[model samples]
Target: MKYQGSCHCGQVAYEVDGQLDGAMACNCSICQRKGSLMWFVPRDQLTLLTPESQMATYTFNKHVIQHHFCPTCGIHPFGEGSDPKGNRMAAVNVRCLEGIDLEAVPVKHFDGRAL
Candidate 1:
């Protein structure tokens, strides 16, 4: 499935092809505060509509994961890595998705902060 998402300020927009069922909700500190649901994909599957310079990245603790957000709006749109093989992925904020019912999408929970 192809999904389109953008930042709250509409500065950053992107289209990605993947199944929503592939999404996961993590119980880590940042994820808990942001309440982000992730849709992980291979590096080849992700396409950024905006320029790389348009996004801002933040990482703390282990720093294996690259958390990308819109610098203009301060919304963490997606994330990548932390797993082996260096697979590029999108840990999108399900709340950022438009029109779909987030609660209807079944999700597996991960204890990210713990592991």
Candidate 2:
């Protein structure tokens, strides 16, 4: 399935294709503060609908993931990183997606703080 998402102000928009079996709620510093429910997909499955320059990127800790957000709205819509095997991946914030039953999606908690 394809899902459309964007920052709060729509400055950063994107389209992601994949099945959202569930979302991961990570209990890391940033993840805890932002309260995002993430759906992971291959990087190739995500298409940017707006200019990449319109969004701001932030990284911390191991600095492996590039968390993208809108400077204007300060909303984190997605993040990019590589898996253990080095396959590029995108973590789409399901909370930023359009027209989805968020209540229906099961959520799994991740102890990112322990990493």
Candidate 3:
């Protein structure tokens, strides 16, 4: 399935193809404060609808993931990183997606703080 998402002010927009089986709620410092529910998908499955220059990137800890957000709205819509085997992945924030049934998607809690 394809999903459309954007930042709060619509400065950052994108289309992602995937079946959202569930989302992950991470307890890391940033994840905990941002309150994002992430749905992982292959990086190739995601297409940017807005200009990349409109967004900003942030990374911390091991600096493996590049968290992209809209500078105007300060909303994190997605992130990019590689899996253990080095396959590129995108972490889409389900909360930023349009017309999604948040209740229907199960969430698994991740102990990111312990990583």
Candidate 4:
């Protein structure tokens, strides 16, 4: 299932392939505050309209997840890195997905806010 997504201002756009494995609800303070449901994908599956210069990266606390957002708009479209060591993986925000049936998707809760 390929889906296209864009930032709030439409400055950042991307397309993702494969069915969303599942939605992740992380309990971490940032995740809780952000309230973003996420799914996993390989970095190769995503195509960015802008180069790295067009995005801003944010990191906090454990500094494992590299949160990338559009510089023009603060909307977080997706994130890269799930492991502390920074291997290959991506955490895609479900909210950014288009034409998705959120209710039918499987969801998992992670104690992230607590981590």
Q: Cα lDDT of all candidates, in order?
A: 0.77, 0.96, 0.96, 0.81
Model 3 residue 98 distance off true place after TM-score fit, in angstroms: 0.5
Cα lDDT tens digits for candidate 1, 1-115: 7777878986777776777774688888888888788777665566777888998999989787888899999988777774475555556666666666876888888998887
Clashing pairs in 4: 27-113, 28-112, 28-113, 29-113
Please list the residue runs of candidate 2 whose C-alpha ends up more than 4 Å from where it truly belongs after superposition: none
lDDT tens readout by residue for model 4, 33-79: 87888888877888887676777889998676788888897888889
What's the lDDT for residue 2 in model 4? 84
Off by over 4 Å in 1: none
- Give per-residue CA lDDT, model 2, range 1-115, as digits (tens): 8989999999999999998899999999999999999999999999999999999999998899999999999999999999999999999999999998999999999999999
Q: What is the lDDT of candidate 4?
A: 0.81
Which of candidates 1 and 4 is the stronger one according to lDDT?
4
Report the error of model 4 at residue 83, Å. Answer: 4.2
Q: By summed lDDT, which 10 consecutive residues of candidate 2 come out lowest? A: 1-10
lDDT minimum window of 10 residues, candidate 4: 81-90
Clashing pairs in 3: none
- TM-score, candidate number 3: 0.98
**After best superposition, candidate 1 residue 62: deviation in angstroms?**
2.0
Give the runs in model 4 whose Cα sits over 4 Å from its true position: 82-86
